[model samples]
Target: MDYRLEQDLLGDKNIEVSSYSGINTARALENFDLGGKTVNLHLIKEIALIKKAAAMTNKKLKFLQEDKADAIIKASEEVIDGKFDNEFKVSAFQGGAGTSTNMNVNEVIANRAIELLGGAKGEYDLVHPLNHVNMSQSTNDVYPSALRIAAIRLIRKLSTSLSSLQEALQIKENDFADIIKLGRTQLMDALPMTAGQGFGAYAKAIERDRWRIYKVEERLRQINLGGTAIGTGLNATNRYVFMMTDIIQDLTGLGIARSDYPMDITQNCDIFVETSGLLKSCSVNLLKISNDLRLLNSGPRGGFGEIILPKMQAGSTIMPGKVNPVIPEMVAQVSLRVISNDTAITMASSMGQLELNAFVPLIAECLLESLELLDRSVVLFKEKCIDDLLMDKDRCLENLENSLVSATALVPYIGYDKASLVSKKALSSGKTIREILLEEQILPIETIDKILSPNELIRTHISGK
Candidate 1:
């Protein structure tokens, strides 16, 4: 309960003596108390990194003394390494165009750096938050730049998870390659295909998403770090602007660049919108693939029953013995959340005003949340679902035999009108297409068997023969 008094433009506020944050963080804590959520730790960490880069650049430019700059650098690195996670308490949905959150980082770094210098916590003469920690940077520039860095880091995780998921699906594709099943359109049996082919289609979708996310890293790399208040680079020297960005790149090893137009980077968040759109695209694909798996894994005895999903848990207490496709169902729900987050991000990005997007904290929250959800969901799905995914070969073949879609294979051999009539008759008679053809002596018994074999159907679809 011990506290120290710290001052800002709004005047003095009491902050915890042991806490890393100062009066700005104190005011932020009071201002954003109505909400339950706090600023993201990922953002806090990135801001610390930006501060560390600024401290180094300022030291190199002789703008700051070595002892103070070195102390600030060490303090900022500690935050980057997750030393003070509980210190940042500002809400993610705050006012001030992310200034509150930015200042919180400044205050925390300032106080921690003071401690590093063996000075009293509230002693600003040794290391001031605004004058020392946030030197040559503004919330408008630092928040956006740090957001981009966080996104790049998150995207890399998502991309790697997606790659693992894709590889798992590819393995299933090969494992199910010989298990022919009925393919459906509009929820009705339409044609014949191997379960491997179906899984391969999902693999391809994930592969494309991985490529899209990889490309987004490059777009996200360009930022407006030195573009002080409104992208004017005001108060920031040329050396600081140039070297700060390079130091950041060196620190993180990301291909980040200072934008030529800091104002554009300041006022517009369309890159986030575009990046969110890519996440939405991937989520949509996941939704489709997950729902497809759920459907294919529908029933052991009642539903389409074409395939069996891995049963991670018992489905219900009263159902006697039922196992659900819980993993795919969980993945589907996560995809829905990601898609909804994308909509929120798009809306928040569109509301940016004359100089800076005031909704950046929300943008960062939603976008990072989406990326985290995708990365976690895709990885869990790969490990719990796709890795042990097994196709019900006998069930797949049985469903194919029962479906009148084999009539589709006969379309080229017997003509569309005749195939339609044959399909209708087979459905009405509850007979297989081969049986009907044999009963009618159409093309003789041997030819009918050759035409109706699963391999022949796949080949015919491929070659149109």
Candidate 2:
């Protein structure tokens, strides 16, 4: 049996055989052979789930008897316990409809179970890969199920990171409550607002995104495990689908359910698109917050100079004194990457044109990468950028005092035109608006205080800290 010359059931007829040696040859042969691995970790997890489900339903499979089933179950337990992670090393991006990955997992589990049974390796003669270990299953059902389960687990971990970041922002909001600053419209000063108000708004946006993720998670729970090979269920029992869902729920402790329309669930990748869109929406909010932080901390001497960011490091070796907002800048870059990955996922989901979506591997890659990046970026942004941020109270107050935005607050006092006159005088002379109003007698001192006091003005339209 020349393993190197093996061909797959699908396309790739022109693939030349590689007769090399060592691990590299093994890898090439794995690719050349009927595709996907023996035991995709995801497939292993799904198989364990199915086993649990079958046990509960008492639906006996022909290949799975008492001893072999126990051995396979024990091997799967080793997998769930994270013992065989190294053996299932074949890339998810394999040939042959993931048969290589499936077979790889199957072989590893069989070998491990053989060892547990005090037997030698490659003893598939006793616990065969296709015969007993993979009874009532195919790569189609197992592959996608594993993919969904892996994605669900990753999304759960990333959601925890997001929750941590949102809580950090809420704490910052309380810390900066009394710090009044000039709010900008189109980069121009428009009104006075407490710094806390801005942080609070960002917090609220993140909270909304968190709820959106919770909703998306529900979509992930509806999987198509029993819809083997284009929803035909050729090799599986009618009782397998619902039982598998229940098994997965018990295994993962997550509320995963079977789809009502197994055919649609098996054929469609739209759920991935929907979930990716939700993640992108959350990334957009993160970008918004990061962009605002960069702008707010732009300059301490020349630019708006309203807020000061934690000086991460010296800006340049050539410059004697310079500090850059590297943390916020890094978060901005990661957010951009996440946004771009979301677009890739969208294209992958949309490109599925046939009865079964072939671009799932691509979607899985993009979604996993996006979620991991977002998870790290959120923690980094919260700790390095938002948490350590400093508010330059005097500078903030000074900028607010000099800004001409106080004219809006005076509309109730001196009328619109008169307030505009005061604004023009203050801007032209570079005097404080309060001073101009008082010196020109356009409004009384008490009226100017009522309208121009930063605290009073911020408290009027904006919520008080």
Candidate 3:
């Protein structure tokens, strides 16, 4: 492969001749080569967007030449459009609070702009990375602002995925609306409820979490884009500071605005913490819903077998015809990982000792990972499991009939002591409460029918009716 020489404060290094990145990115490659991990490309694109917005604003203010700014914007737009993905090599877990990642983007844009201007790559004389591309930004503000934009983009994706999932689950709920099933408390049968009730609860949780994600997105709209270095807007003009955010909002079509106190936005990473915490809530909800599906689909003959998940794959090589709830299982595992990521982010958020969080790279990395993981997991769960879910009506009714705990429904009418007597007799003789009640002539047949109806029971549970 052909190579070109590039220089930074640390001196020169050999970079690939065809590469857009220069010395700083090369130094990052040498320093932070931990398992070939790199910053997410979405984040790099966000950084590029920041560069484009700043350059356009600077050009308007005459802080930068229009030709140079146009070239930089053109180059930055390419990165934002997902070109030169291979140029960003800085690891997600790195030192310098993401300066390496920031410089990597700056250099890639600068070199690409040089090429756009009919100059050779790495020829900073044409469009220098720091002097032109990074004219009015610092790693501190730029990195956090980029992270916020990246997160907003991701949250919108997650919200879309979740909305689809919730709608799919609601469809299943409606389809299963009348299917009577035995509800459980502490893993034992409790009372009669429609399968729809269970699925509706899952849908409700997702809807609630989706709203939470929207709220967090609004919180992240507060950014410190032009707060150069330490949030004082040092080394950047006021016009650039104010106009840059407007340009960014216009470009991204997001509700991003300049922070009221750039120091507050720069010195703290808690907004990310709060956003990730909401993501954690989403993970927990998925865990609960998936675990419930797994349990319901546990066995054909021995386990609950109340519902059948789509046969994604055979459960075991040894166990013939053993299909598993693979999609829900996948969701459960992803949820656990998201929970772990949130914990790490909480610790990383507290790592800010002064005006900057040195651990922001990890925070950004983990947040993006969790978002992508959940977004894909939810879509997969919906398509592979919920979309094709099938209720075992016979099994559900059988379980509902055999559940001794159904005696609780009778207690409200027959009194607890008498219901307990009826329950004991049914348990001893392996009979159902319906049978015992009929033999005892405990109440009118109409009352017994009304008492055991799943819809009525669910309504009573929900509305105290």
Candidate 4:
């Protein structure tokens, strides 16, 4: 472990780590000490974008040779098939503008390609990392392209998770449609509504989120690979950019396009800001829904008493037989974390001072972490919260029957003044409105039924008509 001796033997020389060293997926992984974080193979979504950009330029590089291209293509296929998952050890916080990540992938692909060609270890002479594997590409272009692909992949998973949550809400809407309860405003009972109506609103808000994320996906597909090294296309051929784009398109099946303005591409990380903002918007929606569910399921015996959530575990160690609304509570907690990550993304995007966004590494880190956490939250909500929701039908009817909300319907028949008088009396005397009206004898039973049946009131409640 002597520093000078080790440096002489294995350091500055870049002393050929066996082509097999990099290829020995295990050895590369262990020696790199990359922590447990790998370049998520799911990030192929970003890799695919890079490949397409490179193919578009028709660059005719070593990596594009029939055999080498075929090899990289096959390795990429393995990534899609989820083969090289753990090898993506490049940390999101790495220095050199993701040069370490770019080289990690280049080296891994080169070694794997060499092995595929029946070559031995240290065989970069046959297939060099820079000379063959990364031909016609710089870390600047490839790294950003891959980051975009990774972000796109994360967004897609998030969209699916949100969609599942939306569908669960929709199903609950129909299931709870007939269970009428006292609706609240500012946490105070204000009117009558069906449990179905509340759940339906949640579903609709999530549906809106799915569409907002789709717009971000659209923006992610625009990459700046051909504009290497400050977007000047320096050291790159015009044909290289177009051909690389075409090849990657065939490989990944993602409809990626070259940046119309390459110079702007390097100078700005606006897409990351915009996409992250959209995700934050979705997080806001999720927080709102989580807060609502927590309130709705607040108490089985003490709180709102409107609906029952499926109990997942004991609410407390000291309290016996306690079933808390743990699912919604967990989601609310996760939402706070997601919001915090959004703040990090905002700061990272803003700190981009010059032609290149030095903070991109941090931006990618926060965004990917948020997406993964959101995915877990959405899945937990769909499975533990929404799917198992049940309405306390009798309780709902009981609360609705006693609420003064029914007074609103009386306005048209009895006038607001009389209705207010009746409401105040009923509130004070602890008498049902039905009993008060009957005692007052101002309206007949048939008139009362026509004006204020729960079903009719709920119809009015939903339609506002």
Best by lDDT: 3
TM-score of each: 0.96, 0.85, 0.95, 0.84
lDDT of 3: 0.89
- Which lDDT values do the candidates have, in the order given? 0.88, 0.70, 0.89, 0.71
Q: How well is each residue in 150-244 modelled by candidate 3, as lDDT tens digits?
A: 99999999999999999998998999998988899899777778999898999999999998997788889988877888899888878888899
Model 1 stretches with alpha carbons more than 4 Å out? 460-465
- TM-score, cand. 1 vs. native: 0.96
Q: Model 2 misses residue 110 by how many Å? A: 3.1
lDDT (10s digit) by residue, model 4, range 1-465: 211111212333233444222432333444556576654444533553354334333325543556666665455455456565555665556555665566666655666667788885446766565666566677777767777777776788889988998999999999988778888899876878888899899899999988888768888877777787788888777777776666666655777778888778676777877887777878888888878777766667776666688879888889998888888888888888878888888887888776787777777777787788888889988998888878888777877777888888888888999999999999999997888898989788888867677777777342222
lDDT for each residue of candidate 2 in 1-465, tens digit (9 for 90 to 100): 223232234433222222111232245355656454333344446544554444333334343566666777777677666676666555655545555566666665665666677776555566666666666667666666777777777788778888888898899899999999989999888998898899999999988887787667877877777777777777777776666677678878888887777678766888788878888888888888888887877776777666678787889889878788788788778878878878887887787666676666667766777777787888888888778887888888888877888788877766888878888888899887778777878766666565566677766462111
Model 4 superposed RMSD (Cα) = 4.4
Give the lDDT of residue 391 in candidate 3: 97
lDDT of 2: 0.70
Q: Give the clash count for model 2.
A: 24
Q: Pick the candidate with the highest TM-score.
A: 1
Angstrom error of the Cα, residue 456, model 2: value is 2.3
User: In model 4, where do residues sit more than 4 Å from their true spots?
Assistant: 1-41, 44-86, 114-124, 441-446, 461-465
